[model samples]
Target: MCPLFSNLFEIMIPKLDPTVIYEIVVIVFLACWFIATVLCQFRETKISWFIRYKIDLFNLIPLWTFFAPHPGKRDYHLLFRDKITETDYSEWQEMEITEERTFWSWLWNPEKRDKKILSDVVQSLVSSIPSFREKTGNLNLLMFSTPYIIVLHAVSQCKKRSQNCYRQFMLAESSGYQKETKPALILLSVFHQI
Candidate 1:
């Protein structure tokens, strides 16, 4: 142990052991983190505004604005199928993104960003229907869009057998928050070589 660390702890609390002092420091840190996170919810107040804007160094509070202004009540389903040969097309299978949660998932989730990115790209692709209609003469222009490229890349990365050489993907909307809502077709892509 460094002499400066020991000296500082001794100066802070005279008789306590260094191990007890470390535990105390950790407890205080967690308490402050929890308190600040809760207080950040009331950010319209003066103190909360200060804590959220001025002193939050590590971005400890998450802005939970997933549903604001226009909340998405429908879910977009991406379905793809692989072509084995000229006329032997496979069944359309949905690209299922499961939100698997383990005991420690809140602390370390690798798939969290993937889910968000895919959803955003899908939303953009659905919104690109107008562009697809405008460029009806050339399908290449529709395929070259950013959202289309991203979705194609994601679909091409799916698990496939050795015989699968080409892939096609489509976006469909379904009722996510409300089961009474009707399903609709969004966009269908041409088969592209993998």
Candidate 2:
């Protein structure tokens, strides 16, 4: 027999009691959940805004790649190349309607060309990229949103005014601003009301 198993049997078996095991398990589970909730809430200063803010953890279930800070917004270098701003991001997200349509169509009637599973799998893989450690580095995964939110690094703020016009992607041609013409404009979300 394995030494680990033999040791477990010798030391732990005698103490194992089946009658009260269920109660013990329940107590352990509740304790674990309470601890997790407390930790998530107190992340920033041993007491973070996570708990006070009341975020909907359910909405973040099954993550995706574009769930972090906007790549273009956080990194000035990327934004310079993107040649687009918050307006463009909103437009891009709006354009994603096609993907939704495709998803629905595949849901109703599967087709050979429609590899819907590929998308789900890819997004799931990407969402796993973000971690407590990674947030410290610049490897921001992107959450589909307006460019200005990224530019200002205000993902936490700017919701009331721009709630109506947040998008995930942007089209280069329609964005009205370009990196080549006026790179500075990319940082501003003032083109129009979100």
TM-score for all predictions?
Answer: 0.54, 0.23
Residue 82 of model 1, lDDT score: 86
Error of 1 at 44 (Å): 26
Per-residue lDDT of model 2, residues 1-194, tens digit only: 99999998978766557757877899997886666555554124434344434553563322233535443221121111121453343221211111323456645754432233323322333454355227645324333333323333432233332445432222122222344543322222223333
**lDDT of each residue in 57-153, candidate 1, tens digit only:** 7777765666765687666778899888789989999887635557887798887676678778877776776767776854567688898998898
Candidate 2 positional error at 182, Å: 11
What does each candidate score in C-alpha RMSD?
A: 10.3, 16.6
Candidate 2 all-Cα RMSD: 16.6
Stretches off by above 4 angstroms in model 1 are 1-66, 98-111, 135-139
Lowest lDDT block of 10, candidate 1: 61-70
Runs in model 2 deviating more than 4 A are 1-16, 46-100, 103-194
Overall local distance difference test of candidate 2: 0.37
lDDT of each: 0.79, 0.37
